[model samples]
Target: MAGYLTTHVLDTARGCPAQGIQIALYRVSGNSHKKIATAETNADGRTDAPILPEGKFAVGTYELIFFCGDYLRATGQTADDPLFLDQVPIRFGVSDGAAHYHVPLLLSPYGYSTYRGS
Candidate 1:
């Protein structure tokens, strides 16, 4: 199969898809970083298209930054003080360009978790 990158966010606090959450994709090399794309989560907490489309998939390190603080506030679940979990960044490597990479995040106001999904 051709390779591609995808992601989804779930609002663990609200038990629903985290709509309107901002996300950015970055290519990381050593201490340098280059942003490749930016998108917002749809009603299903997913981007309308693949983050790294088929032909664009490559073997390298990348990061996905999720704006959790803004998301929490938009959903009316923010605290008076600073949020412990503001931006959630996930970094991972791609070794094969012929496989699918699904990174899904389970997010809350103070905590979040992510995993490789099918």
Candidate 2:
């Protein structure tokens, strides 16, 4: 079996999956950045398919930009106050292309966290 990239989002404040959140993946090389994929979170806060399919995995720096501010506004949250966390960018490296990368986000109105999962 080959490797692939996957992600999920949890809205900690709402205590549910963050559906409809937009995310973009970028391959970073020094001062340059190349966008590889774009996806939206499903009802379960996951994409319909892998962000990076098996054969596409590479050893390099990558970034996932989660559109947090837009998601909050769309979900009926007031934007009267400045959002502490807006677009959350999680940058990581893929050292082994043969290994599955499961990056998940636990998000809230004020903060967010991510980790490499199985």
Candidate 3:
């Protein structure tokens, strides 16, 4: 079976879900950017719902912007000089709606990593 767009964020430093993180979904609208949707991570470090409906997906470039600064601050994980990675945008293209796009984030106070997942 095919999958749809999904993501999970893990706070590697705290070894738990990166909750309360602000996330934005943007599509290249004209020569500028326009937000399609916005969501905050649930207790499980996942959006309450899919960023976009499964049936609405099409072949196009999209961006997932993860706001980690406030999340780090709220958790008291790091303060001044914290290596917060603001605007962690994962830009990707959807070739087919039939396939799923799982983009998970494994993050620390200093850095983060993301990849296409199943």
Best by TM-score: 1
lDDT of 1 by residue, 27-58 (tens): 99999999998889999999999988998889
Q: What is the C-alpha RMSD of each candidate to the true structure, in Å?
A: 1.0, 1.2, 2.1
> Higher-lDDT candidate among 2 and 3?
2
Clashes of 2: 0
Per-prediction TM-score: 0.95, 0.94, 0.87
Per-residue C-alpha lDDT of model 3 across residues 38-73, encoded as one tens digit per residue: 888899999888777676666678888999988877
Clashing pairs in 3: 3-100, 4-100
User: Which segments of model 3 are wrong by more than 4 Å?
Assistant: 1-3, 29-31, 81-83
Error of 2 at 96 (Å): 0.9
User: What lDDT tens digits, residue by residue, belong to model 2 across residues 10-88?
Assistant: 9988999999989999999998999999999999999999999888888899999998888888887657467777789
Candidate 2 Cα outliers beyond 4 Å, as residue runs: none
Candidate 3: Cα lDDT at 44? 98
> What 10-residue stretch in candidate 3 is worst by lDDT?
78-87
Better of 1 and 2 by TM-score: 1
> After superposition on all CA atoms, how large is the RMSD of candidate 3?
2.1
Q: Which ten residues in a row have the lowest lDDT in candidate 1?
A: 73-82
Per-residue lDDT, model 1, residue 107, is: 95
